[model samples]
Target: MAVEVKNSESQAKKRAFLTPKRILIVVGVVLALGVVGAIALNQLSKNPAFCGTCHIIKPYYESWKNSNLLANKHAAQGVECLDCHHKSYLEKAQEGINYITGNYSEPLEKLTFTREQCLECHEEDYEQAVAATEFEESNPHDSHMGEIECTQCHQMHDKSKVMCSQCHTFSWFEELDDSWEIES
Candidate 1:
């Protein structure tokens, strides 16, 4: 009877160490912590100041501060850096590695934004923008230029130019103070 009691106690101790409930509790805690950490890091990365930490991005941050470009205007309107600069976790990780290792391009390539992305926010204003400028010459938005990329002339941080000026001379275009003036 004494031997049986000892064996049962030893079995109970072994079972206690490997209990399914205890293992599940540990896993749950780990997953919860991971979720919270990921959320915190993601929020931290979204700050414009955080982006400014990268040397390559400092110029962009400064330009955004000094220029009255769309990016800066958007920031003023409460849009955050990541609102337009979103990338997948894997892509961000790869870029981070390249930046840390000094393997990035000298002039970091500009992020290309799709027309759809712009339209997502500006769809309602598209017609108004096209109609705002009433030059006898065809409205750029309604004409051939409509098919071209918005960024071709609508720089976000720097002074926007009339891309058509490369081929054609529209004196009125030169008279415009800024690209945003087209809407005025």
Candidate 2:
């Protein structure tokens, strides 16, 4: 009977430590910490300085600094690095692992942006941009060439170019050059 009492006392003591209230408090603390840590990491990763940590990204950072491209303008306007360079957390984690292992590709492949991505922010000005560049021979934004990717001519961190010049000639090219230079 005494041994049974002792065992019961020990069990009660153990249960005291893991009472429902205590368990709830511990879980709440852990969840709060997890939320805070995730928020901190996300903010840190969104910083442009964070992107510059990789040596291969230096050229892009420098170009963003000097270029009159939309990316630079957006940066100046307080857009975060991740706003455009968004990746899933898993993808980002894998990339981080690859970078640490020196398994990433050399010459760091250029990041690509889709027209839809650009349109998200520029949708209001899409028509205006197209109209501004409209030429008698072709409406660069509304013609068959419109199907071409925005990145083909609209470099984000470098001098934008007219990819059409490689395959076609137009008098408007000179006008575009003059206007772009003036805008710069």
Candidate 3:
């Protein structure tokens, strides 16, 4: 009877605690949880408010709230930060790491988008935008400067300035655009 008890105890000890089936189940559950967490984070971060959570974004976020800049107009038409930012996930991750490591510059640089990006919602193409605004005298879209950048005239966070105003003596304020001479 003593020999039988010792043999049974040894057999119990030899039995593996984590079988291959149990390992697979644990791995599957962890992967599922990770996927769900990632989805939740992505959805929550889509709102511009999420960008405002960071201290560095305070100025831009505040501008969006009360300022009558182009940003507010875009927001009114259902455009969000990510829509214009268009930064890749990897680039955004690196930006966060740089912020954490204090390896970034102050007075955050203004982000620029391609002409195609602007035309995405504003018009069908650059020519279309030009035609729409040609009713104005100067026709900023059809400039002699040859392919003027939209950002040069249409700032979102700061005051917008007409590029032509730099060279021509246009009677306008700092926040003026092509439609400065609207005949009321």
Candidate 4:
């Protein structure tokens, strides 16, 4: 009887090392904490301040905050960096890796958006945009040179200019809304 009781006690000790329930609970807790941490990091990274943390991105961030370019104007109207520069989770993660590894191009590549991308938040199409500027002396939206890319005249980082001013002088551009700058 004593021997049988000793064997039973030793077996119980071995089984108590980790029951199935305990292992499942531990895994669940770890996964939950990981998810919570990821969520917190993602939310915190969305701020302009976070992007400014990267030395290469500091100039862009500053332009967005202080310049009269479309970046500052858009930020004033409550638009954020990620709002237009949408990227998937994997893409963002890859960008982070590249930033850390110093494997990115110098003077980060400029992003050019299409008319459709512009229309995502804009209520006006090309014709509507032309109509909106009809009161002005010249209609840049309806260029005789064919449909122009919005980014040509509506630069976000650097100063924006009147595309038509390359040859034609729309002197009223500067006085219009301070939106377009004189070409250098």
- Say which candidate scores most in lDDT: 4
lDDT per model vs. reference: 0.76, 0.75, 0.73, 0.83
The reply for model 2, stretches above 4 Å from the true place, is 1-39, 176-184
Q: Residue-wise lDDT of candidate 4 within 1-184, one digit each (tens)?
A: 9999999999998799679998899999999999998788688778978888899899999988888778998999999899998978788778889999999998999989987788788845556777877645677777888876788888888878777778877656656566566664
The digit string of per-residue lDDT tens for model 2 on 117-162 reads 9898888788898888777887767757547777777777766777
lDDT tens readout by residue for model 3, 41-94: 677778899888878887787677656777776677777888878777678768
Instruction: Write one digit per residue (lDDT tens) for candidate 1, span 20-71.
Output: 9999999999999998987886777877887789999888887666667877
TM-score per candidate, in order?
Answer: 0.70, 0.67, 0.70, 0.75
Worst 10 residues of 2 by lDDT: 175-184
| True-vs-predicted CA distance for residue 42, candidate 2, Å | 2.3
* Candidate 1, run of 10 with poorest lDDT: 175-184
**For candidate 4, what is the lDDT?**
0.83
lDDT of 4 at 30: 100
lDDT score of model 3? 0.73
Collision count for each candidate, in order? 0, 0, 0, 0
Candidate 4 ranges beyond 4 A from true positions: 1-33, 125-129, 135-137, 174-181
